[model samples]
Target: MQARTVFITGASRGIGAALARGLAADGHRVALAARDGDALVELAAETGGLAVPLDVTDGAALPAAVAAAEAALGPIEVLINNAGVSGSAPLARTDDALWARTLAVNLEAPFRLCRAVVPGMVERGFGRVIFIASNAGLTGYAYTSAYCASKHGVIGLCRALAVELARSGVTVNAICPGFVDTPMAQAAVDTIARTTGRDPAQARQALERLSPQRRLIEPAEVVHAVRSLLPEAARGINGHALALDGGQTLY
Candidate 1:
C-alpha cells in the first residue's frame, strides 16, 4: 500500500488509537483527533503523527481541525470516523437532550467530517471513509434506543454516500463490532451493574455472551479490519457494514 495521509477521530484510545498506531506503523502520516489533548499529543509523538485536539460534537471546530490536520499531514487520504458516545435508557426516559447529543456525536460529527474531507478525496480520485459503528447498528437492543438510532443512521449515511461516490473512486464503509473491550464497553458494563443488581463481572459476562464467540472484541481486531479496507484492492468493497461481531448478527 502507498503511504497516505490519514485522519482518525476519537483517537486518544481504544479502537481509534489502535487504528492510528497501525496506520502509522504502515508508513502513513496520521493525524489523531480527540477531546483529550494530552493523550492525543502523547499518541501523536509515539506514532510520529499530528495531534489536533477538538471535540467532534462541536460543528464549528471540525473544519478548523481538518484544516490543521491537512496542513500538518497533507491531504487526508483516509478518514476514520470513530468518535462516538453510548448511553442506555428506556424510550420513556430518553430525553430530548440525550437524543440530540447522541445523534450529534455519533451521526452528525461523522457526517460533517466526511463532508470536510471527501470532496478532496474525490478530486484526487482516491480516498477511504470508514465509520467505526456498532453491532447495535445491525439490530435493535433494549434500553439503547438513542445509540441504536444514531448508529443505524450512520449505516444509512454510509450506503447513501457510497452510491453517490461510486464513480468517484472514494469508497465508504462501516465496521460494526460487538461489545469491544474498550473503555466505552467497560462504561456500559458499569452502567449495567449499577442499574441492575448484577456484579460487574456478571454484567461483563452478559455482554460477552451477546456475541456467539462469548469474548469481547479486541481493539487490534478492529484495527486489522481497518487495515484491510485501506488498500487499493479494497476499492471494490464499498458501502459495506463489515461486521466484526463474531457472528452476533447474521444478516
Candidate 2:
C-alpha cells in the first residue's frame, strides 16, 4: 500500500495502539488520538506518529483534533473510528444516563468524525472509514441492552453512510470483533471475577469460551483485518460488517 495519512482514535492502548504500530510499519503516517495524553505521546514517539490527545465524545474538540492531525500529517486518507466504551447492565437497570453515554461514545462520536472527514475524502475521491465495533452490534447479549443498542446503531450508521458515499470512492465499513485480548477485556474479566467470586483465570476463561475457538482474539488479528481494508482491492467491499469473532455469530 502507498503511504497515506491515517487518523486513529482510542490509540493509547489495546487494539488502537496495535493498529497504529501496524500501519506505521506498513509505511503509513499515523495520528494517534485518545484521552491519555502521556500514553499517546509515548506511542507516537515509538511509531513516529503525531499524538492528538482527545476525548471522542467531545463534539467541540473533534474538528480541532482533525485539523491538528492534518497539519502534522496531511489530509486523513484513512479514518479509524476505534474509540469506544463497554458496559453491561440489565434492561431494568439501564437508565437514561447509561444509554446516552454509551451511544455518545460508541455511535455519535464516530458519526461526528465521519462527518468531519468524509467531505475531504469525497473531494479527493479516495478514503477509507473503518469502525471498530463489537459483536454485540451484530447480535444481542444478556445484561447489555445499552451496549447492544449503541453498537447496533453504529452498524446502522456504517451502512447508511456507505450507500450515500457509494459512488464517491469512499468505503465505510465496520469490523466486529469478539472478546479481543486488551485491557478492556481484562477489566471485564475482573468484573466477572468480582461479581461471581470466580478466580480471575476462571472468569477470563469463561469469557474466552464465548468464541468457538475458546480463546481471546489477539490485537494482531484485529490489526490484520484493518490492514485488509486499506488497499484498492477492498474498494468493492463497502458497507459490510466483517466479523472477526471465530464464528461466534454467523450472521
Candidate 3:
C-alpha cells in the first residue's frame, strides 16, 4: 500500500495507539488526536506522527485540528474515527447529561470530523473513513441504552456517507467489534466488579464469553481490519459494517 496520510482520534492508548504504530510501521504518515496531550506527545514521537491534543467533544475545535493535521502531513487520505465513550446505566437511571455526552463523543463528533475532512477527500477523489463502533450498535445490551444508541448512530452515519460518496471514489465503513481487550473494556470489568461484587477475572470472563470465541478482540485485530479497507481493492466495500467479533453477530 502507498503511504498515505492518516488521521486518527482517541490515539493516546489502546486500539488508537496500536493503530498508529501499525499504520506508521506500514509507512503511512499519521496524525494522532486525543485529550491526553502528554500521551499523544509520547506516541507521536515514537511513531514520528503529529499529535493534536484536544477533546473531540469540542465541536468548535475540530476544523482547526483537521487544518493542523493537513498542514503537518498534507491532506488526510484516511480518517479513522476511533474515539468513543461508553456508559452503562439502567434506562431510568440514565440521565440526560450521560445520554448527550455519549452522543457527542461517539456519534456527533465523528459527524463533525467527517464534515471537516470529507470535502477535501471528495475533491481529491480518494478517501477512507473508518469508524470503530461496537457490537452494541447492531444489538441491544442491558443497562447500556446510551452506549448502544450512540454506536447505532455511528453505523448509521457510516452507511449514509458511504452511499453518498460511492461514486466519488471514497468509501465509508465501520468496524463493529465485541468487547475488545482494551482500557475501555477494563473499565467495564472494573464497573462489573464494583457493582456486582464479582472478581475482576470473573467480570472479564463474562465479557469474553459474550463472543463465541470466548475471548476479547485484540487491538491488532482492529488495526488489521482498518488496514484491510484502505487498499484500492476495498473500494467495493462501501457502506458496510464489518463485524470483528468472532461470530458474535452472525448474518
Clashing pairs in 3: none
Better of 1 and 3 by TM-score: 3
Candidate 3 lDDT score at position 180:
89
Q: What TM-score, computed on C-alpha atoms, does each candidate reach?
A: 0.98, 0.98, 0.98
For model 1, what is the C-alpha lDDT against the true structure? 0.94
TM-score for model 2?
0.98
Candidate 2: 10-residue stretch with minimal lDDT: 242-251
lDDT of 3 by residue, 1-251 (tens): 88999999999999999999999999999999999989999999999999999799999999999999999999999999999989899999999999999999999999999999999999999999999998899988999999999999999999999889989989999999999889999999999999999999999999888888999999999999999999998889999888899999873
> Over 4 Å off in model 3, which ranges?
none
Model 1: residues >4 Å from true position, as ranges? none
Encode model 1's per-residue lDDT on 47-116: one tens digit a residue: 9999999999988999999999998879999999999998888999999999999999999999999998
**Each prediction's whole-model lDDT (CA):** 0.94, 0.94, 0.94
